[model samples]
Target: MDKILETDGERLLVAVRNLLEAKGLVTTAEITERRAITDAANPGQGARMVAKAWTDPAYRVAMLSDGAKAAEALGIPMRGMPPLGVLENTAELHNLVVCTLCSCYPRAVLGYPPFWFKSAAYRARAVRDPRGLLAEWGTHLPEAMKLRVVDSTADYRWMVLPMRPAGTEGWSEEKLASIVREGDMIGVTIPAA
Candidate 1:
């Protein structure tokens, strides 16, 4: 009997993409159109809320108290999904985001959650020992700072829009966004040069 070999899921996805591209079916227009639809469906309205909160203390309070209302106030639509809660990273307590069961992301605000965020390693270890897991991802929070691991579930999904690092007071939003890496947004790393 011949033995069957299994391949990784990522390899399988790459194979599918390659197959589609081989047939000249995946054009730039097709990609752009699909992206446009996705963007329309899940806009960057949430990111605006994060920017506002970073600048305004009152808005930050509002976001922490009532995320749905705050997001709506900022023109972000939160329909057909649970009201997302935003966790701001502070010097005292670092916030980490994860979806333990499924990938329930805040698409309207943060665009799309990264693939690694949906990985079993991140999901499982985030809940089990967040500090150690974060360390593996190159984030070393101070001993005094408490680690608050948030779970993204059906009823509510969360995202961490970390505070802008100190030395960037005069930086523009576009410049700020440049430093907001995937890991920083996920709370596994801090914003630093």
Candidate 2:
């Protein structure tokens, strides 16, 4: 695999620059710089929605029912024809999302997909027994939270907006985002902090 991916950096850069120049693009350097900035700014966009749901009940309900609309209500746009669905982790049911057929990620809300999430091993095992799979990931939940597995197919991707953790009565958005792990958003675990 390493050999397969071997490349000359200078050649790659020249190719990219040539492509951009051929497209009659202006300020390629500025465009690349802006892309980096936008990527950094985009990852935390969903944190605002999570914080709002933690503070507001109506929004939470809406989020559980209509994930896309709930995000739109919070001013998050869903582009590229990607369908969004929300899975709620409740006291009696812990929801987990898996795309056994293909990786159907909620990139709009969760930014880039994790390496494990894109693996076939996780996708296959998660569907078989989500509780065991989550346990393997070190997310040990109490027996009270019944395990419920959800499948996100190629047509529709899902994201888990976890329940607000205990002792977060008045926590700020930054604090909340700090505890919101990638696994939590992927529905494999809930935020503890």
Candidate 3:
């Protein structure tokens, strides 16, 4: 029989999982179920939250206060996940999120982090030259606008609440959500109607 080689990380993960299962702390089925849930998560869940916040004043207040609870209220499963912080972009201020140390993303809400989000260059540029980075992504802010780069950590994750486009005032929540892309929530691009 041919041997199937496992990398060191994979081997360690298997060892830990076996130990956990042996101790009755978790089951393989539970792990599979959780992985399925995580795999099913997507940016649409976050966009829905953003859309609801834009149209509902109470939800906006809730989201701005506690993002994780706000997401749970919207039927997004946030259990066992780090606290999520929603950064709002205003006329004079823009918020950008980056995991400076590693790819610590809000996967429970926004699904997996994009490849670019996990890059060392992005992490560095997001802090060292945010305006330039945004501009490169076709997000040109006014010179006077304040750009704030927030770091996402294993303890806390972040998402952006982008400003609603001017012409989308009368649009429904579903319509608004359609325009809220992953990059919009990442603050690399603005949502446009």
Going through the candidates in order, what is the number of backbone clashes in each?
1, 0, 0
Candidate 2 vs candidate 3: the lDDT winner is 3
- Top candidate, metric lDDT: 3
**Clash pairs of candidate 2?**
none
Of candidates 2 and 1, the better by lDDT: 2
Against the true structure, candidate 3 has what lDDT? 0.92
What is the RMSD of candidate 3?
A: 3.9
Better of 1 and 3 by TM-score: 3
TM-score of every prediction relative to native: 0.70, 0.75, 0.86
137, model 1: CA deviation in Å? 2.5
For model 1, name the residue pairs that clash: 46-109
| lDDT of candidate 2 over 1-193, digit per residue (tens) | 6873476878777777788788887457777886774465343666666777787889888887877788778677664546777777777777888888777777777776778888988988997867778887788878776777788866777877888989987898777777777678777777887
Superposition TM-score, candidate 2 onto the true structure: 0.75
Order by TM-score, highest first: 3, 2, 1
Instruction: List pairs with backbone clashes in candidate 3.
Output: none
Error of 2 at 35 (Å): 5.6
**What is candidate 3's lDDT per residue for 71-162, written digit by digit as tens?**
99989998888899999999999999998898888787899999999988899899899988888888899999999999876688899999
